[model samples]
Target: MDRRESGKTPRQLVPVVLTGAMGKYGGELWDAAERDGRIKPGRGPNFTKRVLPDLAPLLRKDALDQGIPRSAVDRSDRPTRGVLIPPEEGGPFPERLGPCGWSSEDPGEFQWDIVTRGRAHWLLARDAVATGWLAAAMHGLPHWADSEPVVFFSTHTRRSARSRFGAKFRTPPADLVTVRPDPLFPELRSVDAATAAVQCLSSVMRGKKTW
Candidate 1:
């Protein structure tokens, strides 16, 4: 429910939409992503990497070692601008790579990496703040469930921004959302411990159980 599945445009993958890079195809896609840090060593990139709201550029930059395939795009099927196409999906994942090799994804954390957190940076407004369960995860809390939807609170995003990208967004009193650099990834941020705790508790008490 939190994913960006709305709008009349086709959000699913289509050929030549992104001028895809010559992706790894079969297992190579994951391999390439891992090699480029688009994904983690033993974990996939969610392939959408909504883990941090600002990770889109970092993730996209980590990829594209190869060039995207060229093809004639049909005018009737041209993708709408500003659409939320998941990364990699728009790439050259052609059947050619399908026969390259036999490989299997480690099912263990695949969903957590790929689905639990979508491409948050693209879906969220640039100034979004990680809060609630996500803040706990940012703080390195253990036993936090990945099944829980990532949550955020932002004052800068438009009111039209919906709860998508595997996360929920809210506008709160500006001072209530104190932020600090994420201890794990200093480049990103999370609500401070107290703020995270309060927000997490507030969600729980309010029965906001969409996740």
Candidate 2:
């Protein structure tokens, strides 16, 4: 049934969604939006921060549970710290990054069946699933089967480039656009990079003839 016919207003129509908002790419987009007056206080796509924990331990346990030989599972890359840390402890630098930790009460929910080295890919997959669910719930729909365009700003990492997690959605939006920063500007700070990226995206969104 149509929402209007059902006499219920949709929770809120999010015209734009910025995923990985805390990461380099997403952070850039967010900062740009703020600077350009596009985003106001409490007005924008739902901000979802991607938080990762050390996945080495969880992956090792998962491998063992899957009957993999102990020698086969590499423990050399095991993380020494959890994702969450005190702000005073030089918060969340590149060295402290890890996989998104599981918070489900059920132990079985924390399975690491995907045996790939792409921790970022795994995290992105989880994020896609979560956003899909959120869209469905907020719109009172069964799934993300609509044609609304979603603009995603991601880094130029190989894992993110090769990730097929977007397709995992039951009905992925066809107009989804992924924006990445120019490789030439590798030394650009987050805010600077974001400013450029957001400008490009804004042009595209405005139907301008530039990339």
Highest-TM-score candidate: 1
Estimate TM-scores for all models: 0.43, 0.20
RMSD of every candidate to native, in Å, equals: 11.1, 16.6
C-alpha lDDT score of every prediction, in listed order: 0.39, 0.27
Model 1: runs farther than 4 Å from truth?
Answer: 1-62, 65-110, 113-119, 122-124, 159-165, 181-185, 209-211
The count of backbone overlaps in candidate 1 is 6
Clashing pairs in 2: 52-99, 52-100, 53-99
Please write out the lDDT profile of model 2 over residues 50-88, one tens digit for every residue: 122222233455556767566544422331111111112
The regions of model 2 sitting more than 4 angstroms off are 1-50, 56-107, 110-171, 177-211
Clashes of each: 6, 3
Best by lDDT: 1
Residue 189's lDDT within candidate 2 is 16
The residue-level lDDT of candidate 2 at 5 comes to 14
